[model samples]
Target: MKEFDFIRTLKKLSPLPWERTVGNDSAFFKLKHKRGLISKDILLEDQHFFSSIPADALAYKSLAVNISDIVSDGGTPRAFLIGLGASSNHFSILSALFESLYKYARQWNIPIIGGDTVYSDKLLLSITCLGDAPQNPWFRKNARLGDYLYITGTLGSSAWGLSKIPTLGHELSDPHIKRHLYPPLYLDFPSLFKNKIHAAIDISDGFYQDLTHLLEESNLSAVITPETLPLDPSLPPEAKNTALRGGEDYELLFASPLAPSSRRWPPNLQKIPIAPIGKIIN
Candidate 1:
């Protein structure tokens, strides 16, 4: 018997939510919330992202991608509702996926309010993240030309880790693999929440592409420095280009006046490596 996939079957259901490729908000009602509107994207087989990845990994990836939008917009993810399609065949994997969602949701202090489940041929996860800010959310347009440029963690580490699984030398733990498996959300949104961060985003897509959203929205330009960027130490010289351009690190990229380098933060943000990747020029 051929393997059943939830996503494959979910797509075949009658009255698909999306409308003809023009202007469509037919499924908008499903996104309603109290403090903020909800956002969701359904992934069918071979769609959204690479299809060959594991189900649990896919579940986390689905959440990461959706939350990235909320993080970039400076909203605290209050909760999420995951719509799942998993048949008996994939139930184990699907269970692991939802379990991971609960893990992350709890870690982030967000709730898994509710969702729908259905039988499907292949796995499909339609995740919706809900969040809001006091004022209008942080956006690509708020970047100031002279504001400081900053980012969290090294660039391309996730992509690099996946491509080159480092030799597990005397190491007992697998944080690196876990990182690839479950991309971490910094949650230290001081920049956005404090209004101290000027231009900000999470590196969900490749760093090279996503930053453009900020520049274009701000009607400004940028100049990234080769040295200041935090790249993976394991990356050879040949792979630097791909690492820099290949996003998905999901680290935060925001502009703020130098954070307190004098003292340490409980879980601090470093000042180094986060150099002037580029300037928002007038």
Candidate 2:
């Protein structure tokens, strides 16, 4: 398909009320608040993914990382714009990508407004996501001493899955491999306590390294009980260390005051399994 055809296809898929398709040079969005959050993440062919990965999975990830940022800030994702660069003549790949992106957009209730596409040597995707920043969104600098550091879901699974991707083809459907290819849309957890969390970040760059970012942003330190890490039980022993250093888990690492014993978080999140693994200090 040509560039215009691709744009038309996207317009057909986007049914959100705020999406305005014509008479304007840019897509229109409705922002309920004065403050907004905008974030971008780029995926390069060789550096970010191998050539063998499915186009659909790559498309899903292109938007997922950006969604991770919006919710991490305790904001609700409203819309996005995608920039695509590709040299391949296979228009079917482009179709698959658009379909995959639309699928995720509907699941998250976010819309793809507008973007530019170009021909390049390899597949390249740049996504810019916009959202309404909460009145009291979580910030890295808000971490305070004595607040418990908690993480939702397991770590190291993405790293483990990435390691196996080379040997296994796109058709391979292992759970760990699926985790790496399709990170969960965990925005629900952040939305539950929107203005209440102390500090928050998605564990995209491994748990420990991202924790360092939180500490640096807050100018505070933390003491983690290594034994308390919520590691993936399925990871092999040799890959255990990846739990701390492997990136791309995309789980939320957040800080909150200790809750009362009677307090129960949204039980719907039970499937993701939240855990308190450490405390901010110094």
Overall lDDT per candidate, in order of appearance: 0.62, 0.80
Candidate No. with top lDDT: 2
Give the clashing pairs for model 2. none
lDDT of 1 by residue, 1-282 (tens): 334454444333412222221244222322223446346768765454443556566767788777776776666666677677666666456545656677667767766665666667666778888776535556768887766566767776566556544354212144544566567665556442456666577886777777787788889877777677877676667667788787568777775544435232223444333444655667
List runs of model 2 lying over 4 Å from the truth.
1-20, 260-267
lDDT tens digits, residues 1-282, model 2? 654565455446554422344447787778987899989998988899887778778888888899999989888888888887775443557667777787778877787787776767777888999998888888999988888888888899998899888788654469888899898677776667754588999999998799999999999998888888889999999889667899999999998875524264554555777778888889
Off by over 4 Å in 1: 1-37, 44-56, 164-177, 190-193, 257-276
Residue-level lDDT for 186 in candidate 2? 72
RMSD of each: 7.5, 2.6
TM-score of 1: 0.73
